[model samples]
Target: MTVSAGSRTLEVKVLSAEGLTVDRKPVTKNVFVEIRAETLNCSTTSLGVADGARGSPSWNETLMVEIPPYARSITFDVKCKTSMGTKSVGIARIALSDFLGGIVPESSLQFLSYRLRNWEGRRNGIINFSVRVKSAMAPKYEPSVPVPMPALADRGSCGSQMRVPSGEQHNPRGVVTGIPVWWTNHSANP
Candidate 1:
């Protein structure tokens, strides 16, 4: 449950899952990790590096995530691994949920539930990490504003360019232009 800043990416590593139980039974064994990441304006990508020695190792696998151009934030889930004398299994209750909540919006919390269900009876040696991103287009109620008239101006020989005012500006019709009128301290509120 630790996150560090990497070069142009994030290094998220799962410390360990505490108080693990199986079928209403307390179990004790070495538990690994399955990390999943989902963000806005991007698809879910699984991260891992190839290594002969299994288990968990620091610097073994660095979750190098590139910040999406339009992404504001991301969310992820961590599932712990269990061993049964020779078979490694992924228990549903052994998973924990955490998110980097910001301006980004995820698809739904239900998806995490679905992933936990997938490991019901399967004891796969490999830890499964499912990562998904909710694009900025998920919002359906965003209202559009009218383009300002003053923003439009001729560039001489090339073509006419349109500029829109942003925030607020003096308009006789009480219309808030979308173009940015000022970059410094200037309030258009009236």
Candidate 2:
């Protein structure tokens, strides 16, 4: 499979969160934001935690992440730290297309707000953030060279081609324990 490259980077600023809850109880203080792309790469707030605020908390921090062209959305995991340990309040998935505003310019900031959903799929809170796409320079193109294909062995009525490596023995499973298997056959022939 060929992997395509992206042309821009996303700068995300996690502003704050409001009306958050954990297990039907209002969360007050020690709240932080965890932002992640659908691709699994993530970033967490590094500064002071939002503390002492019940239900509503403020962070006002910025996190920058590269946005691959194939990425469709980003997820935010909101949690609060307490004596009992950290508890997840809710998560928010924001589509890149919704805030990217079609064609991304050199540097454009977009303020957005989305509702947060708990693991049970219920509305739990709201998270505010700002996003922008940093334009990238066009890549220079070059001529490509095609690689030659390897030769294939002929198969008889058995419909299977076997290649035994030098100084290696094949187990009953047709695999050499310590050696790598470069070819495989789907035929029933032994």
Clashes of each: 13, 1
Off by over 4 Å in 1: 1-8, 39-62, 67-146, 149-190
Q: State every prediction's TM-score relative to the real structure.
A: 0.28, 0.62
Error of 1 at 17 (Å): 1.8
Give the per-residue lDDT digits (tens) of candidate 1, residues 1-190: 2222221233433323333344554334433444333343222223222333332311223344444323343433323334534222343432222332323333332222222222455432323333333232211222344533443233221222233332233221122233444243233332
lDDT of 2 by residue, 117-136 (tens): 99899999898888886554
lDDT of 2: 0.67
Query: Per-residue error at 53 for model 1, in Å?
Result: 25
Q: What is candidate 2's TM-score against the reference?
A: 0.62
